[model samples]
Target: MTGSTLVGALVVGLAVGAVGRLVLPGRKAVPVWLTLALGVAAALLGAIVVGLVDRRPGGSPLLPLVVQTGFAAVAVVLAVVAAGRQTSPDPAARRKEEV
Candidate 1:
């Protein structure tokens, strides 16, 4: 990918990732960096998917943007799930539960 494409992906990723996080209920143990990375990857994947599906010689820009955002949302959900699995329990909570 070209530098511009990467930069665009990053920008879109940041926005899409933030929206994804906002849509989910409850706290996520995922770090900001991880979320950002997920967003970036998702955005690129979304772009690729849209590019493949769109056969028009000159397609509308809106469709690709929407598709990319959707992909980012899916990635965020996965990231959140993974983060939930990896989060360490608080010692106090564990002790309380044991008691």
Candidate 2:
């Protein structure tokens, strides 16, 4: 990827990640670093998908963005779910033990 593309990926990733964090309800226990990482991954995935379909020399600038955003949405949701699974404690598993 070009330097500009790399920067774009980072920017997109950060935005996607922030959105993911916001979309999740309840307590947001996710760390900023993790969100950033998820964003980067989502951006990468989106870029790959777009690259696969966007093989033309030139075309509308909006379609790729839409694809990327769509991918970002899916990725962000999945990331949130996965993060939630890992971060959320099992309510049933925690028995009330008296000391």
- lDDT of each candidate versus the true structure: 0.78, 0.69
**Candidates in order: C-alpha RMSD to true structure:** 3.4, 3.9
For candidate 1, give the lDDT.
0.78
Model 2 segments beyond 4 Å from truth?
Answer: 86-93, 96-99
lDDT of 1 by residue, 73-95 (tens): 78988989877766336888777
| Structural RMSD, model 1 | 3.4
Residue clash pairs of candidate 1: none
Model 2: lowest-lDDT 10 consecutive positions: 90-99
Find the 10 residues in a row with the least total lDDT in model 1: 1-10
Q: Clash totals for all models, in order?
A: 0, 0
* Candidate 2 overall lDDT versus native: 0.69
Best by TM-score: 1
Q: Each model's TM-score, in the order given? A: 0.73, 0.71
**Over 4 Å off, model 1:** 1-6, 86-99
